[model samples]
Target: MTVTDGVQRVLAELQRFGIDRQDVIVSTNVRTRLDGLPRSGEREPADSGAAVYWQERTGARRVIAIDHYIKVADNLAAIAATLDAMRSIERHGGARILERAFTGFTALPGATAPSWRDVFGVPPDCHDMAVVRAAYRRRASSAHPDKGGSNDEMATLNAALRDASTELGKPIGGEGS
Candidate 1:
């Protein structure tokens, strides 16, 4: 979806919860425009989208942002339901969508690095890092053309094999692994 559309949908969600004005926090799956990550600024991180809040009343002594149990959840429905209840609780209107989060994977201990190939679901054999590396080294050398293989074949195989090896070195999961 377009960024503006995403923003609108979120705003509608917050309004449905009645947290559309006083004070609110919002977040979403960051896009290329959010951080200027892309040379063209067109890449969006839709895979990661979420938001939470710490709402406050203008002069209420004890501000209750307790609706977090309703929102700040994992998927869209919880957000919608929370917003609906929040709107019901507030009566008129209250907050707005604030910001969007980004798609990121938690770095795990010895997590194999993601391969460009993995985005397409190819797995590299060998769980041990050393073995994987050695296998790649051998495959790349044999695939090289100076030894007599076609340059096209060598280039294709060696590159694919190398890419797979690099991916195997790290863990998968774009984010939140």
Candidate 2:
């Protein structure tokens, strides 16, 4: 199918999930002619991506983005393949949305560091220092050098604990003031 057809299908699918067209954002790199007009069809190469932004009745704005179709040679093929994948997802079950705030060092470009919450395997809303420390200890058991883990792994756990504790305004080894 053509790129336009793929886009239309995507919009229709989102509508089925109660997401309004106004709440969705479509994006793509458009190939242009010498006269500065967008190329009409999928013949040209461009990177295509889109995001559906939505909010629960009393929740923060959240997004489900599909931007990984870069392997396709041209924008048209990329969007077509993406539509097929979305349809497959619908066939099985709808996409599951997870909420997490990408923060601090994790937000930087090319930074592979996991967020504190990710390192501790805790949900974003779990901010109690006691819970974070318990998570740290649980992970530390497997990350400590004596337990067949490398120094780097243990160091990452330590850093994760420090960052999380600081963000929570709690002392690392003592009760909060």
Best candidate, TM-score: 2
TM-score of each: 0.27, 0.38
Which whole-number lDDT from 0 to 100 does residue 133 have in model 2? 89
The root-mean-square deviation over C-alpha atoms between each candidate and the true structure, in angstroms, is 19.4, 13.1
- Please write out the lDDT profile of model 1 over residues 1-177, one tens digit for every residue: 344443445457655544544344444444334432211223444354455453534432222222223222233344555556766655543333211111122244564354534422334454554444455456556556776667765555544455654655543312221
Alpha-carbon deviation at 10 in model 1, angstroms: 2.7
Q: lDDT tens string, model 2, 73-145?
A: 2333454455567667766755542112334445578977778899999898887998998998999898899
Q: After superposition, how far is residue 132 of candidate 2 from its true place, in Å?
A: 0.7
Give model 1's TM-score versus the native structure.
0.27
- The C-alpha stretches of model 2 lying farther than 4 A from their native spots are 1-108
The superposed Cα distance between candidate 2 and the true structure at residue 28, in angstroms, equals: 67
